[model samples]
Target: MNLLFVASECAPFVKTGGLADVIGAVSKSLATTGVNVRVLIPAYPAVAALVATGKTVMTFDDLFGGRARIVAAQAEGLDMLLLDAPHLYDRAGNIYLGPDGKDWHDNDLRFAALSFAAAQIGLNGLGGWVPDVINAHDWQAGLVPAYLRQDGRPAPPVVMTIHNISFQGVFDGTRLSALGLNADQFTQQGVEYYGKISFLKAGIALSQKITTVSPSYAAELLTPDFGMGLDGLLRERQLDLHGILNGIDLDVWDPETDASIVATYSATKLAGKTKNRAELEARFGLTKSDGPLFCVISRLTSQKGLDMLLDCLPDLLAEGGRLALLGTGEPYLERAFIDASNRYSGTVGTIIGYDEGLSHLMQAGSDAILIPSRFEPCGLTQLYGLRYGTLPVVARTGGLADTVIDANEAALLADCATGIQFAPINGLMFGHAISRTCALFAKPKIWTAMMRRAMRHPVGWDLSAAAYLDVYKSALAP
Candidate 1:
């Protein structure tokens, strides 16, 4: 079957988070199963450099106040349809934000245009190759189904996948006409949310199927806690929703073959991992320790529960554990972590920015990875840790709960314990989780066994792609 993916970002070319990785990996994995996948992403500088040289399949005289065209290209082993609109997509540094550190004023029009283009492609096949199914990812591509519905054409079935429900593309309801939204469709039953128009809600309300990054998150979206104000609509469309777990690109994340890490290692041969750990300590200016070395590779946001981690840091250091953190987000969290690094000195080392290579080495080197998220929509770092034999210490929520088998006695006895999981997201529990991890690390035999088990865990996309195919088949059903 031929499939088209409409997403804001894709791996290697442009990425702000796991959504891009998912798009790139899913396309490749689905292709292995005989699915012809084409991803439609904005022509950011990196993508434009490669895709601008490809065939121009479709052009627009005027789309959302600018001339635009779609360039079909193949790069990095993936087929992509680049929306080459410089006026909308061309900028330096961050793609979504301007130099002023605020969202670009034209974001609503920008992504709406992307969705509008997708609707066009769905209605009129590109280059005589119509997509059998269109998978719209995140709120950026949320209006694809709505645009198709507005066109009133027999379009390919659209599957709206919510990578994170918190980022719904909501704007003024008064700008419905500016967005080219049908005035008649502005009721509560339509794209209307409170007094505004939410692109994510429009997609959820109009699409044939809905999916989240993980099954556990799929269930979480039904409750008020995780719904982010759209639980009512999600409850209404519960039958159409699916919770398909996400998988990583195993080839890219493999510890043995990854060129980004300082040393190569695997489940069977873990000697190199020791070398990597030493190298990681040196990079972060951290002191070597006999205790567990924990790494955090994530956005430093409250939603990630980094503050709680800060509270547990003193205890972690008191227990002889070491930390190496690499990420940037939220001004306060960044300051706090920096402060901790200074106060804790050799025990805590923090990098205030993101480095892809450093992240890979951290996973390869660290004895464990910390992901105590208050709420997670299927984190990919934990999966990468699992693949690298770095046991994950995570919160018991969303995909973290679904993926990691806690190192409880039952799981340990079965020799299938992969990582540590803590519940009741609070400082006390988080501290206990850290202490528990330290205790587990003290047991060398059990710790090594768990690492091997984690490395053996299936974090690849084979099963996930097959599950996506099944969803597509179901959507195409008469």
Candidate 2:
């Protein structure tokens, strides 16, 4: 059970989104299950820092028309291989973006180098350590499968996981020559997507199996709404697609042992949660109160339905509830939340950036977490909210539809509900959901029962990892 994971980012070493967390946690979990899992990522500045502590396992002179090497290291308790191509990955800014707040102009070449190196390693073993399966993640490493197929050699089975369909890594068709891709590979059934070369499309077309983050999302992607223009191709390969719901790293996310929060508390002993609530209020410059407090920790993007939440803010405040938001995206949305905080000085507070520690404290302190995403693949915040006993108010879509048992009349009566879920994903529906949560909060006994159920929920990676193992085995079949 030897596996190689190729991705642009990974947690603890470098990260820009939930993809990193998934790769990090899932790889570590798989390794524990007797699978020899090794992750390969570009040697970004943050990753390059590890070279001092790591060793150069292999070097290559014929990759991306430049010198590249594979440096072995340890990250997040998993074996890591850094594709050290300084010319392509030595930039100082974010992984995909430049300091000027735009995507790097040479991003196609940068990630192409990464994929080429991965393909090389998959075809030819690195230091006699060939992987039985190659799993490429997101559009960043989407070229791996394509390159492997183009090599026309015996290679390990390749699997591509689409973390987000929005970013397809589209580039001019003329750039194909730079990547050493044959012109014949560019076609409607190949990588050509509307006269452009689509990295994600290539992976989806050439890979033996494809997977998304959640079951609902996998189904959603076959339709035009969530497909981002590749729905037809995805439908053609629907049988080979899977939706494995992602899980959080329990050891890193558990509230009982988390060092980030102001106090540690479990479902039975909730006194520490009260202390954390007060601390959170003070930290956010909000007046302490007994009203239900809701927290939002997500990218302030339209996809996340933040505008809908903003539209319902006044109604939520009128219900005698408080809100705390932490995130940064879409400058206008950031300003909108800040303006809302100013308008409702005491009832609303916002931090216009991301902080891991602050996010944990918010999860621990808030009575409910707000996740009104219109089409989430598999939200990690809602999962974290469930783990911390902070009921999530998520839209009924994607993983939210799969993981959360909506706190309706039947579920509540059965004592199996974990959180609140609403449909339509609009301002009015979100407002109603918030009102429902506030009413639930008024009943301490019922709310506590729901919290207990949420705390007891299984959000670990064991089940999801086993499903991935099945996918890997299936890919290797025949």
Candidate 3:
């Protein structure tokens, strides 16, 4: 199988969130299946610098108002095609945001150029390499299918994967001609969404197959609450939608061999965890607690339900549970967590920005990882928590509900409890879940058993890669 991944980011070269991790891991995993996989990403300055030895395979005279070229290279253990458009992708610091901390105004045309390139690559092979299938990810590459359709040529089937429905990439319909889109297709059944051109809507409506990160999330997208205004269209295409759960790269996330953490540990040799916990405490300035040391490694955003964490802090502190949070997003939430750290001092610790090494240490040391998301599509942290024996206490929504086997009495009795889950996301329920975790932590035997079980849980990408292969084979059948 020849697979081409069209996306905005890929890990170890470029990453802002879990999507990049998924792309990097999935491409590697699929490669092991004897499938030829190549990912196309914008050549950011840093990324382009790494692939300096690459060979140019394709060029364009005018791509969305710029001269551009595609550089093909095998770098960082993956095959990548770098779209080196200096006018579109040569920005420093952040790829999506400008110096003012706002989205780049030309993101529409920038990504449209990316989609156009992907469509062209699919339609015409690059140096004896033609993709049999194109997998488009997120709103950034959402126009891949749309472009492929506009060509009216027999092109490879495109699979559209929605990482998060919240970001639909809605832009003005007036740019239809400028984006090289057929204005005649601007109908409710086409790319038009709420009188605007939605890149995501075009992919969802035109793609041969649609998938989300988790099965629970796949099912959730059919309803009004989780659909984010696309439920009707999703319902119309339900037959073509599939929910394939995401898996992490175990080699990168293994607790026993991770050099990022202070002390290595496994399910059997858990003593090293204590040392890591001590180091974590010293780093976070947290006092050693008899209760659980819970950590939150997520953005300080309302979507993450961190405000509720603020409301639930007293309950957690009263129960002797300490907190160490490391992430940055939303000014108000950042100030709140920073202020909480100040007011609570030894019991609470907060770092405004994210550090990759510190995140590994936090996972290795924390007894539990709290993820109280309002709605999570597929959370990679919970998977990392499971891999590291850091039990995940999460809301019963989307992938969190799918991944975490809540330590309810039935689950505990069955010896299958992996973490804690609470529904009806609010301060009360979240606080109750924290109390439940504390109660479990109090029982050393039960807590240890749960930790071992969590560590034993399979979180790697092998199974998901196989599932994707099946999707490709079926899409190509007949």
Residue pairs whose backbone atoms clash in candidate 3: none
Q: Supply the global lDDT for candidate 2.
A: 0.91
Over 195-272, each residue of candidate 1 has an lDDT whose tens digit, in order, gives 999999999999999999999999999999999999999999999999999999988999989998788988899999
How high a TM-score does candidate 1 get? 0.99
Alpha-carbon shift of residue 255 in model 1 (angstroms): 0.7
Compared with the true structure, model 3 gives a TM-score of 0.99
Model 3 ranges off by over 4 Å: none
TM-score per candidate: 0.99, 0.98, 0.99
Angstrom error at residue 330, model 2: 0.3
**Per-residue error (Å), model 2, residue 238:** 0.7
Give the clashing residue pairs of candidate 2, or none: none
Which prediction has more favorable lDDT, 2 or 3?
3
List clashing residue pairs in candidate 1: none
Model 2 reaches what TM-score against the true structure?
0.98
Worst 10 residues of 2 by lDDT: 57-66
